[model samples]
Target chain A: MNHRRKVTVGGVIKYIVLVLVFIFLAGPLIWEISLAFKGPGDNVYAIPQYLIPKTPTVNNFVEAFHRVPMAHYFANTLVVVAINVLGNIIGCSMAGYAFGCLKFRGRGFAHGLFALAMLMPTEGLLVSTFLLVKSMGLTNTLFGVALPGMVGPLNVLLMTNAFAAVPKELIEAGKVDGANKWQRFVHICLPQVKGTITVVGILAFVASYNDFLWPLVALSDDSKYTLTLGLNRLQGTFYTDPRLVAAGACISLIPIIVFFAIFQRYLFEGLQAGGIKG
Target chain B: MARSVTQPQGRGDARNAPSARRHHRAIDDDGPSSWLFTIPAFFILLLFVFYPFLNTIRLSFTNSRMLIPGHWVGMENYVKLFQSDQFWTALLNSSLYVVCVVPFMLILPLILASLVAKGPKIIGFFRTTYYFPVVLSAVVIGLIWTNLLDSRGLINSIFQSLHWITTPIPFLTDRWLTLFSAMLVTIWEGLGYYMIIYLSALANIDPSLYEAAEIDGAGPIRQFFAITVPGVRSTMTLILFLSSASAFRVFSEVYVLTRGSGGVGGEDITMTMLIQREGTGLSARTGYASAISVVLLIIVGAITVIQQLIVRRGDD
Candidate 1:
């Protein structure tokens, strides 16, 4: 009875610690939300910080939207994300089919290349990639920003792992029924890896949406600016007032926040499925 | 675009005949058509990734400006990079950042995962909140933290209200404090990401092991170190490699917080920032940038290879 009581006490303590950890993680964003809602006259330096504002207002968000072309930036970012996500899904799925499902020569070499590509710090490739984009007359264009990330090595690897998990007999059955390799992939293998494809697609979606440095460097036009670049510019413009900048940050963050909330299960499930085992 | 081009052909094939093509396969699946599956990715990778990689290496030998080409300087770019004090400072700061950040990123998540390993379904909601920052852009995190770190910001206000300190802490300004402050931010951001990895790992462990351990009168801590840690050993290595690699490439945090310096005194400068500065600064030397990049690639690549070797060897 005493030992069981000790176990119960320890469980309570552990639960308390876990709750504190959650507080530490969620505190800043909660603070940011309060800051965003503070009106121009509210005391930001309140002696006792409050998670909720004294008099909440949407003026900061209005100012954030007014300070920059939030709509334009959102549309531009969506375009880049759409193109990159589409490219990663199609190109990576195809590459994955070849590497995972087909018994082709040079497959080992190809897989090795993908692994190496996955590890190389992309910051190292920035200068040359920028130069190449420039030389191709693609500067100030969204496509230039999207092109380099289109077929991500990591996504390709994840898709390969996903496709490999599909029963081999399915593809062989399609092949025996006169389906060519392409048909076998399109009709048979693709459906099996749909969940995984969604997993990789969502991963790519988050990345492209949040990408900053490449878009900042590759595209010089305001019209081409992504949400990060636009929000940063707004922060620069509203240097003295953090409340307005917080609003901009909230704007840029909401979509992915919504996305993760909806598909949080997929992210957890994908890891268990070994989508990133490579 | 890839779908548009490939889908129509598949439809065309389907319309032609269903039974005629059966059993008439080209003797083997390893026909010339295999290239059709791999070629699109191959082309993009060759055109963008490989071609520029070669260009970067070639440019390292020559004093190539962004727009103008110069004569090959042999090993001068590498020589200058090795001797630069700036390079040493960056190397020290980056190394310090890695030393501080990677361990926290690895272990804390395991603890949290174990803490909430089999709790009620609401753990998902808490898990989402923990992982929230991972999805947020680095720039936004930078901004949020910057607000909190300001002289009269929330942190200072709280500190003073609690009588912890009379003056506001120079969280983002002091030379010595900047990297540590950045490390704190990193720890916060990484907790959720690595937690998910560890949680998934923890889920896969046999519940029977814990039940058996309980039968032996083992406590939770002993059970963790004895079984849980060992069960997820490979995951620990994976997170270590990932966090270490990212630490070596740290940029957006420092860039946003200091508006491009470690602090007011320019105490922090990462290798990535150095490459950007050299590549695009008024000095405008692609050769130097390439050399720095090559060094970073070598260091990061070597670590990557070593980690993979360990992981692969374990598999063998």
Candidate 2:
């Protein structure tokens, strides 16, 4: 083929492939949104399933809200998210500061421990953690679900990368001015990595909010279930009812999507920013 | 944000010079305050991660169960797990998932990052669309896909209407299809996360490398292999290990989609699900579950070490 023809053909192929790929990616989601608006009697799985239902209603959503106590779940998740974010920010940056700025004994050993901690999968610790929580009478409480996730070693690794990016001169200047460690951290280090902090905050929020396993194991009571656990329950109970479950799924996902979009700039920047140090 | 001048000012105080020396010595003796500040984090991690990991190793030897103290079972649980078909099946299933899903998840994210990174102003919209799934937990994704794959659901409906198939396929109900179903949902959830990682790595790749490759008359595909892949090798290894680990630890999709029954032909229950089933109050096979968990830990640890060795060899 000639160059112009080949270019046009490639362009067409790219557009077509992109469009098809987009459809595949978004198809299930679009279908779920449609199912949420479906009426009670409609056979949601029936042949000729309407992409736009003949009789759209909010009944599924109403039933979902009543059955799941979504507000309570939301409240529980919010509290869990808040605590997790706070812990990550303080714990990670503090640890990161030690790793990045301070010369200390066994620092390499300590850093290796943090890396090993990141490598240890949560499943391996599940049973023992459950036992420990049960023993402490923390089971079935919000604290139990949120507590284990608070100080992730990965956060420390991430923040250390962020913290290390602060110029050595900055820390040295603070030291020369006779600033105490805490003062240096708060006044100098924190502001320099504010962007990293914001990124970590969003990531922590997303991870904690959508966390399923711990919340499921820790809180047996439906009243204290996070949105994730609530979604699981909704699916199990309404197995045959696609509309209600889809509605429930929509409710669970919308808040997160909204939050992420609001913080997209920070989220994107955070991903790249942490890697720059490497 | 003003730097504190108190310590130096005190050091310069001639009237209290001896006391100042003592104070400076005390401060020096205190050493790194960053370590002091991080004590809360260390304490919490020790109480949770380190202790629980040690406890898992200990508990694996005993028949611990809910509402009951475990008796020492020696290696019986491990032996039983070896003999059990269920344990092998779950192991195979999880390994298959890692093998199948890791490449797709890793490669697709790299492709996506490259494409979106090069695209114009509309990149954010495409990114948001792709990443929208990352916000949904596995349960929600499972529910939506389960419905869409049901016999009378959207997939069959569209197919049937278009005469693509004469009959509805049992997507989730069938064993082979169920694994793919899980993979589909998993890939959706995983893509955005790795995409973020790749985007970060991509940003760090010096543009001059690509420019140099371009001046050498290297095409896009050649440049991608030569420049982009090599540029992002470390990040790729990090993501690959993490993705593989995650694949091995899946529970939510299995729980929601099949509830450990393994779907139509008993092909869906992963190792984590098996442990979960046996550990719960209903069955209470704590020793058996603990053995399974220990094996899992060993498998993951082994794979991780192997991966590190392989990656390190390439680096050398």
Candidate 3:
């Protein structure tokens, strides 16, 4: 009877803690979402500070879209994301296939190089990269933002591991039927590793879409600004509408929310497959 | 089905067997094509990633600038960095951030992951709820928080309403509170990601161990220490190294919040912020910034190596 009472009490505590945790985690984002509907003149803080705006409207959204060329930012962002996704899929998968299936000299060395590259954070190399990109005459171009991310060491390593999981018998059988190396890869390897490629593509897309520092450094003009860069310009040093700022911020979250909503299964599966140990 | 479309390509290779065999024999049969295939990635990384890395190290020795020419200056930059007070202050500030933020990033996520792993009933809700922040860019989060923390903003209103404080607090522009504000933002943005990682790792752990522990009358807390902790040690290590490295190199939050002002009397100045100041701030001391970058690089490298060693020894 005492143990039963203890269990019930414990259950209650768990539920309370989980709810509080969710609130704390989601509070700021939810607050920003709420402010999106509030106008500039409305008191951002009314008595009791209405968590839900009473007079919600889309004017703020329209103002943001009109003031900034939202479509241009969207186009630039989409172009970069598409290129990054394609590059990451092809480059990482091809390299992953090499490391997993085909044996050659310096395989271990190449793998180690990729791992070391993964450890070198982008911040550490920002200065030289800036100069390098400048020298290439690619500064202030979308290519500047998209080029460096063309092939990621992390994706290479991830794909290598994922490719290794495909049964060697499958590849050997393809080769036994006189299929060439390219044929074996196309026929036997690519389909088996589709899940890894999809996951890597999604991750690359999200990261490229949200990246700020590199793009800010690379792209100089206001016209080429991605959504995050454009969002930075919305609030001045002082004397700006916080509600409009909040509303503008909310717009950036929509694409990510939509993407995750669509591909959540692939994201989780990829993360689990990639992060969990054999 | 899409599956059938791919099968024709597989079947085509089988149909053109003789020609495919000829093509295979014409090329070197030792699979040197594997190495050939890896060349694009190799060159791309070498030129962009590795080449820049080497150049940065070289520039650390020189008097390089953004807009002006520079020449080799030997170890002068290193000497200056060691002697400068700002260098040490920034270093101290970064270390403080890492020390304070690392534990919360690890522990909070671990606890959250455990809660979600309890059952599938609430898993969907928890996943989306936690992951929602991970979707927002750091710039967006930075902008939103800056508004909330302003003197006349929502936080002050709430505090006043609750009678917690009689007057508004300068949360962002202040010295200590500014650092705390940045820490809070970093934790919020990062918590979901680490939680997802822990959840995945927890999911991968065999459930029979938990069942065996229950049979032996082990409580949840005890089982957590004995089973769950050990199971997730590698993951915890990875997260620790990544978070600490991120903390040491923090610039975006500091930049957006304080406008690269650091703190009152420069108390909140981080090494990365100082680098930015040297490069583009009114000073535009390019050579000096490069020197600062060298020092920052050394500090980050040393910390990463130390963490890696600790993790390795613990694993052994």
Q: Which candidate's lDDT is highest?
A: 1
lDDT of 1 by residue, A1-278 (tens): 23433447788888688689887888888889889999866888777677777778999898888878898999989999998889989999999887767765566567667756766678888888888888899988988888888887767766766666677678778978998777888898888788767767777787788887788778767878988888778767336788888888888778877887787866655443333221
Candidate 2, residues A103-158: lDDT per residue as tens digits? 56555566667767766777877777888888899998998888887887767766
Best by the TM-score measure: 1
Clashing residue pairs in all predictions, respectively, total 0, 1, 0
DockQ of 2: 0.35
Q: Candidate 2, residue A92: CA error in Å?
A: 1.6
What order do you get sorting by DockQ, best first?
1, 2, 3
lDDT of 3 by residue, A21-104 (tens): 887877777888888888655688663466787778888888877777766887888888888889888888888788766766
Runs of candidate 3 exceeding 4 Å displacement:
A1-7, A269-278, B1-29, B263-267, B280-286, B311-316
Tens-place lDDT digits, model 2, residues B147-192: 8777787888889999999988878888778887888878877787
Instruction: Looking at model 2 chain A, report the run of 10 residues with the lowest lDDT sum.
Output: A269-278
Question: Per-prediction TM-score, please?
Answer: 0.91, 0.88, 0.89
- Considering only the true interface residues, what is the Cα RMSD of candidate 1 after superposition? 8.2
Measured on C-alpha atoms, candidate 1 has an lDDT of: 0.77
- Model 1 Cα displacement at B118 (Å)? 1.0
> Local error of candidate 1 at B96, Å?
0.9
